[model samples]
Target chain A: MTAAVEIAGITKRFGEVVAVDNIDLQIDDGEFFAMLGPSGCGKTTTLRMIAGLEFPTEGSLKIFGNEVGTLPPNKRPVNTVFQNYALFPHMSVRDNVSFGLRMQGTTKSEANRRAGELIELVQLTGLESRKPGQLSGGQQQRVALARALVNKPKVLLLDEPLGALDLKLRQEMQNELKSLQRELGVSFVFVTHDQEEALTMSDRIAVMDKGKLLQVGTAEELYERPLNRFVADFIGQTNLLDATVADDDMIVLGNGTKIKAPNPHSPGTKVAMSLRPEAIEIGRRGDVPADHVATSLNGVVSAMNYLGHSLVYQVKIDWIDLEVRTDPVASEDRLGPGDDVSIWWDRTADWVVPDE
Target chain B: MSGVITPRGASRTLLSINSLLVFLFFYAPIILLIIFSFSDNRNVGVWGGFTLDWYGEFADSQPTRKALWNSIQIAVASTIVSVVLGTLGALALERFTFRGKQVFDALLYLPIIIPDVTMAVMMLLFFAELAGVLGLSKGFATITLSHIAFSISFVSVVVRARIAGMDERLEEAAMDLYASRWQAFRYVTLPLIMPGILGGGLLALTLSLDDVVITQFVAGPGWTTLPVFVFGLIRKGVTPLINAVSVVMLLASMALVALSLFVQRVRTTDSA
Candidate 1:
């Protein structure tokens, strides 16, 4: 099957500044894809290009195998839910939802009936006559959603739709949006800066930075194996230690400890090793598991933080510091600051990433 | 308590007296004009018994009635022309950018910033030149054209303010929902800026009605608006009829201004 959207060599420039650099991306049909990045990373711009709100300076954009690079938004088979909801303030909830249908020459009664069903679908019954000004923020969001979804486009582009909501309301809307996409079986190109939101909601995420597509993968793949130093540090918490490749399948840490791991780079090449805090087991010096321990090191516990369900200890090995997270209930030996501890991890838990 | 003389109390009394003087300063002449308009005496200032004779004379005079009709015609025609041109100018300035846009923007404000006498001279010269070439004569058409020339600036200023405060994404959303460019503007942009359009039209009407200097410059024979005719009447003498006409104009202007304020208030409440 053809992809919902196929963007090839897309580049958007505003005068001398490049908003979205040359990048290629594909969103599968019915896939919940997220464009994740920091602010001004061009994720929103890429989404706009697909929605035909902004034409790419140089590229070909196809939706279901049709070239629509320079086509106006009205001619495209896609819709967008803007960040600010952008509901027509003078229009009632029903009228706002039915505006697209009316523009398509639907009869007034027929449009009203369809809009009423959509309003009910968004759980906004009994608000047919109320203007957007009279609705709360969440209600307005639902109206915006219904307005775009009423068109029944092949793909829906959402630009940080939940960024304005409070934390609890945002979480609620995230779950709702995920389920909505699932039930409708439409491709959703969600643009957001929140890593957790992208990881939790998107089936596949494209991480962008500085107008560049850094990585695109499933959540587990991105978490387990980040391609570079930036992706490793951005996706989640990790202790990135500067190391030199000692040989093939081995690397040496700063403190001269050699560890057996898969290394694609030649010897003497500098790299960064990503080790998750939860992957490291901390205990007394002789408590290493014989089968699981690929390497072990002795360190002094500099600080300890109680995180209710888990305990995080800052372990200092020579001049390098590593954070080790431990389950409070599972471990009987409680470690405190100034205690000597040994930390070990399995070989698969550590991966080498490029120093960029 | 009555005997106590606090500094705050003294200042409060002074402030109240100051406010009373200010109110009297503004409304005293208007109040006197209304009272004298009803006087039975021929002299405007004389304290004669109340009568509606001047109002009856104002209504009966054929010249006054003709001038009033002329004023209404000019005001209505000028307002319609100015609202269309001015709204288009405002949309262009606010929504697009091109070469020489700064120059165009600055020139839009020239009519508003220039003195009335200068604008009158400018229009007079313009029509004089046009007449020499195109055989255009100064009459109802010339007067209406001049009124529109000045009133366009005011309408555009008001409309531009409304456009500036609007959220442009609403138009984008309309187009994203399958509305063509013209349809988006007709449905989304026009309804949103309607209050400003109405306000601008009423303001143009008031300006055209109140104009005397420019109309006197461009008006030909028998094309005298009410304000110009009133100014001509003042040169001969101030009569109770003139006072009645002035009061009538004042009431009409106040009503238009009140309607403009009402429309603006509705816009604010709708957005809120």
Candidate 2:
């Protein structure tokens, strides 16, 4: 089947500054896709190009095999939930939701009937006559969602839709949005700076930085094996150690400890190794089994942070410091600062990434 | 002593007295004018008894009626032309950036910045040149044109302020919902900025009605607005008829201003 959105060599330039550089992507039908990046990373710009709100300076954008690169936003078979909701303040909730239908020449009664169903879908039945100004922020967000979804476009473009909500409300909306996308079975192109939100909601995420698509993969693929240093640092908390390839299945850490891991690069080539804090097991020396240890090092605990479920210990070994997360309930001994501990991980725990 | 604050009650009393004095100073002449307008006496400020004779005379006077009609015509005509042009100008300045935008912006403010006498003189010369070349004599057209010229600035200034506070994303939202560019403007932007347009139109009407200096300079023979006619009447002599006319003009302008304020209040509440 053809992709819902096929962006080929898309690049958007505002005068001299390239907001979205040449990047190619394919979002599958009914797929929950997210473009994840920091602010000014061109994620929003890429989404706008898909929605036809901003035309790419150089690109061939196709929606279901139809060329829509220079098409106006109104002509595109897509809808956008803007960052700020952008509901018409003068319009009632019903009118706002029914606007797209009305614009398409649907009769008022027909539009309202369809809008009523959507309002109920978003759980805003009684607020049909109330203006956007009268609704709370979360309610306004729902109205924005309903407004965009009422059109039933092939792809729904959401630009940081939950960025305005409070943390608890945001989490609630995040679950709602994920389920809503599932229920509708429409492609969703969500743009967000929050990595956790992207990881939790998106089926496949395109991580972007400096107007470039750095990597595109599943949550597990990205977190487990990031291609470069930037992807490893961005996805989640991980210790990226500067190392050099020593053998086919080994790498040397800065402290000269040989770690047993897959090294894609040639020998003597400098590389970076990503080790998740949870992957590293910390205990007293000689407590861990010798067979389970791929590499082990003795370190002194410099600091500890209690995170309710787990304790993150900053372990200092020679000149290198590694963060080791341990489940407080599983471990009998409570480690503190200045305690001598051994940190070890399985061979599969560490992945080698290019230093760039 | 320097750090000590004034007592609340004492400061309140002082502020009340100052407010009373200021109000009295401003309204005393207007109140006297209104009261004397109802007087039966022929001489100014002398009350023989309460009577509606001056108002009757004002209604009966053909020249005064003609002047009033002329003022209304000029005000309405100028208001319509100015509001349209000014709204377009404001949208251009606020929504787009083009070559020489800064110069155009500065020029839009010139009419509002210059003194009335200076503007009047400049308009007089402009109309004189137009009359010489285009055979367009200064009359109703000149007065209306000059009013539109000055009123455009005021209307645009008010409209630009409204546009500035508005969110541009609303227009984008409209377009994203399948509205064409013109449709988005009509259904979304126009309705949103309507209060400003109404306010600006009222302001232009009020300014056109109240104008005397510019009207006098541009008006040809037998083409006098009420204010200009009133100014001419004042030169001949102040009469009870003048007071009645002044009261009527004052009340009409006040009503327009009140309506403008009402429109603004509705906008604030609607947006809030």
Candidate 3:
């Protein structure tokens, strides 16, 4: 399928600050794509540029198959649901939904009829005559969504649409949005600072930081095989340790502990290893299962937290804080602070992340 | 705790007394004027039996009628001009950034702060200086122009505040929904700022109708406004006719202020 939105070498500069550095990205047709980043990481800026609200300083942007670099927002074949759900205060829900049609010179009756259908589609039928302020936050968000979707643009851009909702409501809306995009079969480019929301909804995710695209892949791919230190640390909780390559399948940590890893670097080459906390097993040195213990490090528990279903232990070994999470049921002994313990993980669990 | 009033209770009482005093200070004179306008006797401030003779006399007097018409014409003209200029000024200041913005903002407030007598003198001198070059003379045009000069500032201040409170994202939302630049402003921004525009226009009308000092300096020959004519009447000594006219002017201004407030409330509720 042809790409719905293709951005090539787009760069946006505001005086001296480079808001969006040169970047190339594409959204496949009917794909649910997400741009994930921290605040001020240029994710929102990239979305705005594709929506034609911000002009790119360099490079070209195409929507579907048309070059839309210089086109104004009104001329673009895209609609955006803003982060604040910017509903028109002065218009009724029906009028707000019909606004795009009216602007397109559709007859009043036809516009109203189509808007009525859309309102019902968004499940807002009884409150059509009410203004925006008369509705709750969720209702207002639904109206914003209905208003944008009524135009039936080829692509829909959402800038943190669920950011304002509570956790439960956000989860509910995330599912609804995913189903809605699936039903419409239109490309959706969602921008959010939320890692879980992106992972739960997107077909593919783009990790960005400091005006740079770090990596892009499926949720599992990015989590399991992060390309750099930033992506490795950002996707999920992990313990990063400074290390140097020892041999073909081994690396030495700063604390002089040798660990088995698939090191692709030359011997003595400095590297950073990312070990997921959940991947590590914690127990007394000889109590652990022999087959499960690929590499074991003896340590004393500095702190331990009982988290209902699991226990998290912060093991101190030569000034390194190695976090190990173990299911409470699996570990027969109750570990506490100041207790001697051992941490072990499989050889395949430690992945080498790029240092720079 | 048993003997002392709570801070909230004490503040409430103080606020009530202060509000009462303010109401009396502002409404006492207007109430007296309305009551005296209905008095049978011609002597001022002393109430006789109820009568409608002064109103009848006011309706029959040609000079007062002409002066009222002239006041209405000038106030309407100046208010229209002021509304346009003020709305533009508010949009310019609120929607764009440029050099000397702070200086321009300070200048917008200057007309409101300068003494009316000084403004009148300044306007007189300005028109006098331009008379030879532009054939500008003191008449209906001069009075209307001077009223507009001060009214624009009031309008801009009110409208600028309204615009500042508004979210610019509303316009961007409109554009995102396929509205052009003009359509976005016309549908979203204009309706949002309408209350401020109406308020400023009514204030301009009230100020122009109530103006006496500026009118005295700028109004020539028979182009006397109601307030200027009334000031001339007061100098000769207060009359029943003067009280009647003053009551009418008060009612007119009150009606305007009431209308503006009503419109504002309706707009707010509609949006809300």
* Docking quality tier of model 2: medium
Compared with the true structure, all predictions reach lDDT values of: 0.91, 0.92, 0.89
Listing every candidate in turn, what is its Cα RMSD in Å to the true structure after a full C-alpha superposition? 3.5, 3.0, 3.2
Clashing pairs in 1: none
TM-scores, all candidates, are 0.94, 0.95, 0.93
TM-score of 2: 0.95
Interface DockQ of each model: 0.63, 0.65, 0.72
Cα lDDT tens digits for candidate 2, A222-317: 999898888999999998888999988988988888878787799998889888999999887667668756677788999988899899999998
Chain B TM-scores across candidates: 0.92, 0.93, 0.90
Q: Put down candidate 1 lDDT per residue, B63-155, tens digits, no spaces.
A: 999999999999999999999999999999999998999999999989999999999999999999888786778889899999999999999
Clashing pairs in 3: none
Query: What is the descending lDDT order?
Result: 2, 1, 3
Give the C-alpha miss distance for residue B53 in model 2, angstroms.
2.4
TM-score value, chain A, candidate 2: 0.94
What is the per-residue lDDT of model 3 for residues B46-119, given as tens digits with 9 covering 90 to 100? 88999999998889999999999999999999999999999998998999889998899899889999999999
lDDT of 2: 0.92
Off by over 4 Å in 2: A255-258, A267-269, A285-294, A305-308, A329-335, B1-8, B262-272
Tens digits of per-residue lDDT for model 2, B1-272: 79976657878899889999999999999999999999988888998799999899999999999999999999999999999999999999999999999999999989999999999999999988778787778788999999999999999999999999899999999999999999999999998899889989998999999999989998999999999999999889888999999999999988888877987788777655
Reference contacts recovered by each candidate, as fractions? 0.77, 0.77, 0.85
